[model samples]
Target: MRSRRGALSEVYDLLRSEIIAGVFDPGAQLVELVLAEKYGTSRTPIREALRRLEQDGLVERGERGLRVRTRSPEEILEIYEVRIYLEAMAASTAAQRRSDFDLIRIRRAQETMDDTSTDDPAAMAAANRAVHETIWAASHNGTVVDLLTRLNNHLTRYPATTLKTPGRWPEALQEHWAMIDAIEQRDSARAHDLARDHMTKARELRLELYRADPSA
Candidate 1:
């Protein structure tokens, strides 16, 4: 039999993944009884999982109960604002601490981005995430990585990628290349500035995309 804690963790991961994948629409009610039935578990584990998801900011209290969290355009911008600082810090630390192997992993992620078709924005976005995740790992700061990972979860809850913005892809690719170069040279200050500027541009484009399509 699965341990109680194991069951809770399993349900939490599945629920989080479903939220991230849009299996649960934004604002969809998450009932403990329904979820317990769906996952073939007791309400105890489902309740615990929902609580964990709430703490993760993936779910929130609604009029009736908990539901998947949805952000307004302004809320999304605020998320990017927080991301900007965290990403800069990660870049600076990564530059100072990254080993050659880390550079290799970063380069590999960049190569994946390069190979991704612009016509498929979702693939491009996933590739972009790969590069950023590698940089975070290179930073080797567990606290920063944990915080950024959580922030990233919130960001991904929204549909559409800013890379889909016209003329944004090429510029973002250039910025990623520049960041790689700075990290390779161990230029922490320059890496910090580049990462900050890169995210600032992304945030601007995100606002533009939102304005163009409010549903996004």
Candidate 2:
């Protein structure tokens, strides 16, 4: 038997995963009764989950009730712009402050990402996130990590498949390695520039996808 908080947490996690995976299409209605039935939970947990999703920016409270948040091309670009600033700051700080152990952890995360096959978007996303988090932790900056975590919550609303395009994964891995190399060398300027460029390129890819499929 699950406790009330446990059930609500489970509901939140499941709904968030579905939203990130594009299982629930953008702007789709998330009716409490229907979600309750689908998850074999009551409306209580479903409502709790939707409220939490709203806070995470994965869902919005509309006149019709709860609906998945939809992003326009412009909005997506804006989000990336914020990410670029935050990630670059983290990279720069990490370069100047990272310990040998921090570098080792970052290298391990990158190697894990490199070993991941391109066939699995979820695995790729998870690996990518791990590498980023490791970099953030190496920075020794709590505020930067908190900001990036919030930004990531919003980013989860976007389709994970956006990272699955041809040649993108290898390019991303290379970029991560370059940032790590800069950090290991204590080249703050290079690390900052590379991190910013990496995010800019990713934003361009996302924009291209949006242009190709306006409905997506």
Candidate 3:
């Protein structure tokens, strides 16, 4: 006994997941008539679902109506590489400059993240941001923190955080644990290396995803 609202919600989730996974491909038009047929619904629900996607930044309306937004893989890579260097420096500085209280805050952030389900992207993204921001604070560099925050916002143009990718959560969690240990031990080099490796691995996985779906 699914209500119309329930069906519309389901359709929205289905379309959102597909779009993020690149199933719809960038710039692919989402025609109301085609979607209505595909989801076995009226144009009303289809429109509702599309409006949600548009609001989410997963779609855009032009002269041709709604199309999946084009994601520039090159820009994604460039942004990531920049983050890698900044994160490596931040982690190293954090290891050198952090107090016990700073470390405790970072530990708390990761614990919160671990307690949340990976299926919830918003929660994971929020936790992830908190954890990183804490580390940046520990670095005691306002300039770097401000720059990284801006860079992170640009990343939303891509799919959500890589934390929710299949099999990535556990690996990422372990990496975070190791990073915490390195920073706690005041091993600046180790912390820097771990941070770089973590970002590098994520970059590789994300590039593969972009390569597989060459619609844009």
Pairs in clash, predicted candidate 3:
none
Please report the TM-score between candidate 2 and the true structure.
0.90
Give a tens-digit lDDT track for model 2, residues 115-143. Answer: 98787888998899999999999999999
lDDT: which is higher, 1 or 3?
1
Q: Per-residue lDDT of 165-187 in model 1, one digit per residue for the tens?
A: 77888889999999999999999
CA lDDT of every candidate: 0.91, 0.90, 0.84
Instruction: Evaluate model 2: give its lDDT.
Output: 0.90
Q: Highest TM-score among the candidates is held by which one?
A: 1
Which whole-number lDDT from 0 to 100 does residue 2 have in model 3? 87
Off by over 4 Å in 2: 160-163
Q: Rank the candidates by lDDT, best first.
A: 1, 2, 3
Which model scores highest in lDDT? 1
Candidate 1 or 2, higher TM-score?
1
- Can you give the TM-score per candidate against the true fold? 0.90, 0.90, 0.66
